[model samples]
Target: MKANVGTLDRGLRIAAGLILIGLSLSGVIGLWGWIGVVPLATGLFSFCPAYSLLGLNTCRNRPH
Candidate 1:
């Protein structure tokens, strides 16, 4: 899979995911906070399946 996640999107996802995980770990939120791992993993991988299906590319445009 190619990198469909752009820098900004990846940063946001990582930030949000980290916050979720942190909250859960700190008992500030429910275990559901761990669900943020999904976005985190996707951000790390830079490949989002939904983006692929939707033809949404957050990554930079390449020359044809």
Candidate 2:
């Protein structure tokens, strides 16, 4: 997949994902927190299916 996620976006995704997972594990949030995996994976992989489908690109170093 193309790297549509940029550095800032990736960082935010990762951070948000980790926070959600942490909250879930700590019981601060319900199982829904597991959804954080989506962002985490997209962030780590630098590819977001939704972004691709929406024709959005945030990575300056990569071409859509």
Candidate 3:
């Protein structure tokens, strides 16, 4: 899949995912924190399925 998530967005997702996972491990947010894996996967893959369905593209133009 194409990279629909931009650099900054990807960075934020990674950070948020890590934070959430950390909190979950520490029992700070209960089991809900484990949901962060979704963002983490999207961030790592640089492609969001929801974004594609919504026709959202944050990636800047570049020679392909």
Q: How many collisions per candidate?
A: 0, 0, 0
* Residue 5 C-alpha lDDT in model 3: 95
Order of all candidates by lDDT, from best down to worst? 2, 3, 1
Top model number, TM-score = 2
Q: Against the hidden reference, what TM-scores do the models get?
A: 0.92, 0.94, 0.92
Give the alpha carbon lDDT tens digit for every residue of 6-37 in model 2: 99999999999999999999999999999999
Alpha-carbon local distance difference test for all models: 0.91, 0.93, 0.92
What's the true lDDT of residue 30 in model 1? 99
**What is the alpha-carbon lDDT for the whole of candidate 2?**
0.93
Task: Give the range of the ten consecutive residues with the poorest summed lDDT in model 3.
Answer: 55-64
User: What's model 2's TM-score?
Assistant: 0.94
